[model samples]
Target: MNASLKLLPLAIGAALAVLPAAYAAQDNVQTLSNFKTTGNTKPAETVPQTGTRADALRENLKAIKLPPGFKIELYAVVPEARAMTIEPSTGVVFVGTRKDRVWQVTDRTKRRVADDVVQFASSVTFKVPNAVCFSPDGVLYIVEQNRVLAFPAAQFFGEGGPDVAAAVVVPQGKLIPTQFESFNHGARYCRVGPDKKLYIALGQPWNVPPKDKLAELDKNGLAGIIRMDQNGKNREVYAHGVRNSVGLDFNPKDKSLWFTDNQVDGMGDDIPPGELNHATKAGANYGFPWYGGGHVRTEEYKDQTPPAGVVFPMVEYAAHAADLGMSFYTGKMFPEKYQGGIFDAEHGSWNRTKPIGARIMFTPVKDDGSVGETEVFAEGWLTPNGEYMGRPVDVQQLQDGSLLVSDDYAGAIYRISYAK
Candidate 1:
């Protein structure tokens, strides 16, 4: 045997020793075995796109206000839709839900409306597969609560059957320490960066984690964003101190990372504003626990001095807006003013005295790369009586320059297009 080849076992053992205990060899082996099954004959579960529920969603579009020449229409019905990614080759939109299912929405006739909405890879049992994104080469990545799976050539295999070919990128309970997992703040967001690395947001699981938990949370990336190779190797935390960021996108211009952060709750109705942050480099900390949101000191750490070099948000939104998913508009279908702007979804507030932000906000990027003032691009989801008609979760831009907004509250995706 070659001299270097003789050391392979030693190298493997060294690496395994450093990994967390949750990544046990036995558990990973079992998870891999489950993913490599032969094609499943079980039919994919299809979501009904028509009927009373669909009609009610379409009617709500009339209440939404958009700029002149812009219109919103129901695109598809995807239950608990949170994050979305489109296959570049086929225009197939894969949407992730807060539940165990990830949906594949297809428009077969090239029409704007979807012809089919079915669960993708139905046989694989997922846990909160709320983050779905695609690589430049059409590889599908499903980032779950504590696992990440990859599907190569997903555009083709997705239509084959319920058991589409899959490979475990990050095994169950391996993305973060299993003990730190919580029911709240678990929904994640991921994006394939310009360097072709996979980036995932790791929401720290608490309204405000106790002081004793902060070190562990940051070390395991449960309170920050992490990145790794597409095959889930060489993983490292990209940003630190994020409370819970469900929305993030790369600025098409300078390639800086921008994301929205939901701040701590129970701080009253109108304080500690939500955040739209800009991350220009790795290892950047966006203060949490110490500074709740937008430099507002948290009650838990108001007396202690926060770590130096904490980055503040570029834009501080209204308190309790619950800003979630966002995307930079790269399509030419919109007017010149919106050429390189952002469309952010505010899921709205759950506990505020008066609910706010069940609509889309547009922020323009100036020529010098500064973010312009954000303005409301769509509204009326919150009714005159303050009831939520539909709460938007994510925004995805189609190839034709139109945009798709996913709403978990309404269980549907709405398309927005502009024409003069």
Candidate 2:
């Protein structure tokens, strides 16, 4: 009687009858040069040789359990890093690379430390840069693919260093213009919000569904969440249907924003499940392609009934589980049940059929913030039969409280702590 609960009312009546014809054939907005950036054309590669299978990468990460002293470590390796940022005046730790490069580890003995790496910024033919924030005046924001550059913490610790060509700084309404074949979704993960505004996660030119006709079922043409003004002017639309949110954050207790989407593949290996939104206002739509997560909905927006203002998903993760970077631990050195919680990374799934998120999930937040059901704060890099070596993505927090994690599939950064 539980064959997956008898296919839940036929997947909720076929996602409410094709959500308004996928929003009346979306309204034309496809143009990001058709999403194509091979990200680093492959060349400088080395750093995936963990012996004894590296303790099986910690055996499915022991299903993570934490809460009694808290402890975890692997910390510094910096191979393909991914997305990360931390400067607090000089503990360093830049990181950003799908290959175009940008690193600067440091800590060379400031004590509560662990870095040494250094590349600073290089080549740049637009590999998957992703994101790398900073700007409390030290500058350093970057989010390649569609562009959004900046750099000047003395040009990334100068002495004639990190000048990927210097003179970089694109803050004039944050350049947004790519979308050719569809699915450019390249707003890439960005951050600087606490109202300092500069958020950005865009994704959705087309992972599927978009033959054009005003973008087929258009809800503003291709996914959402944009916000600007770190000089990028008042460009608004803080939330709306999102289909590739590469991890975003802001809940330092109510600053409220939180993100982590990444679902929408031939729709089969278990329907939909990768989301964790929570914008609240400023645009709020959260339904992507139609509707996903519990209320399900999305056969191209099935017969449209999910509107009353559009916004759903406070938690849901499993389907593709490619979550990506997100942080919000606040820190005290752990145990207080890992304060505030919400540390996502899951870069696992490659269009699924096995592999489910690369591991590191936490959830649990409520004092009015909501979300309260995820767990497995860390798990073996994949292999209950799937076989993956490392993926994780982003999750920072280290003024000493510990927790760094990057792992562009084993380029390494990990440093989760809690020790007695």
Candidate 3:
């Protein structure tokens, strides 16, 4: 048997022998690793187009299979909203768009409505704004292909319209530049860590590269989490070898950071699975091209072995799920069973022979922040014949204990709630 394959039976036996023990360990550590990135190329810029396709599709959202007395609703009309963030004080929601604009949606009268949609920020030439987030103090941070900009929360949404030109420039180092021909992941997602520092997700430039050329790998070198102070200073690598992580969230109770990574495509349908990881410490390397899921080896990283102290994912989802944004439920609106569960939006898949992952998934989370088995939360977005209605991109928990889901393909945001 091959040396790598030898590790599998052992790992599997270990997993099965002490499954409960493994769960105990997971509850304690709350981390995992090793994955790749996958996404469609950024769309080209075009004039703003209006539509009711998203509105029409909202009626089709299916109910999650849950206990009785729980209900979910279509919350708001946010066209083309993805990578969402909510301002705690005002309950105002902000989302980035593929049209190079950021939109703010407000909740009123138990309904979410677009109070005022403005071109909050713009990319000179890029097709989309990568991500957006609000700091604890209410500062709005927006990430473009090659730049990071911030505006005061109160000032941006105050009586006067936001002065986009007056926003503070955040130094993004060599990661983003004005002109770049190649080697840019450009899927920058950010969140505030337990330590109050900003953690940004930077993707690998290539899925799998030639083994001899390690430097090319470094271009995506900051493939994992990049930590920086609020001012974007003291930047350092929090972890390494992550391909691309679009969905990231910090557990409010344990203060641990969690993320969802889309694995590399073109691999056979079931060779490797999508991963859910936790950022445990600074400088930890999760196996990437080198190692995956404890024993799965890739051609590009054959000789390399998983380094000591490297972590693996807490749980694995179906291959080609295209898992994206993740958020932990910490609200009182839902049953206590869902208080700490994770809601992840699977953007669906393009590289698979069979369509998968067009809906949101739920994973039971322990008090210590480790995840349990994953179950389907919502479905029916994909037709039985494999045609897709919408692709979910992100999920966020609202101040009022509701959930917001962003669907980039249909350009709509749907709200999931529970009620007696």
Top candidate by TM-score: 1
TM-score, structure 1 vs. true: 0.92
Tell me how far the alpha carbon of residue 66 in candidate 2 is from the true structure, in angstroms, after superposition.
3.7
Worst lDDT 10-window in candidate 1: 24-33
Local accuracy by lDDT, each model: 0.86, 0.64, 0.65
Cα lDDT tens digits, model 3, 1-420, are 333233333333333333344432332211110111112133322223234653465456662333466555555556677899888677877788655567766554545544344444222222456688877767666765545555455334332332232232342234443333134456678887768677788775567645654444444344577777655557777877787788888877767778887776777777578988887667777777675433466776777765677678887888888889998888999888778889999999888888898888989888766667798887767788988878889999888887888888777777777787
- Weakest ten-residue segment in model 3 by summed lDDT: 29-38
lDDT of 3: 0.65
RMSD to true structure for each model, in Å = 4.8, 20.9, 15.1
lDDT of 2 by residue, 45-128 (tens): 233324544445445345544456665655566767788888777758788875566776766675544535656643233445
**Candidate 2 overall Cα lDDT vs. reference?**
0.64
How do all the candidates rank in terms of lDDT, highest first?
Answer: 1, 3, 2
Off by over 4 Å in 3: 1-55, 62-68, 108-110, 122-127, 154-159, 176-184, 212-221, 292-294
- What TM-score number comes out for model 2? 0.32
The TM-scores of all predictions, comma-separated, are 0.92, 0.32, 0.80
Model 1 residue pairs with clashes = none
- lDDT-wise, the better of 2 and 3 is 3
Give candidate 1's error at residue 78 in angstroms.
1.3
What is the C-alpha lDDT profile of model 1 across 1-420, one tens digit per residue? 432224324433443444444643433422323345544466889999999999999998899999999999999988988899999988999999888889999999889999999888876778899999988867788999988877766767778777565566786778989887777988889999998899999997789999898888988887799999776778999999899999999998888899999998999999889999999999999999898899899999998888889999999999999999999999999998988998999999999999999989999987577888999999989998999999999999999999999999889999999989
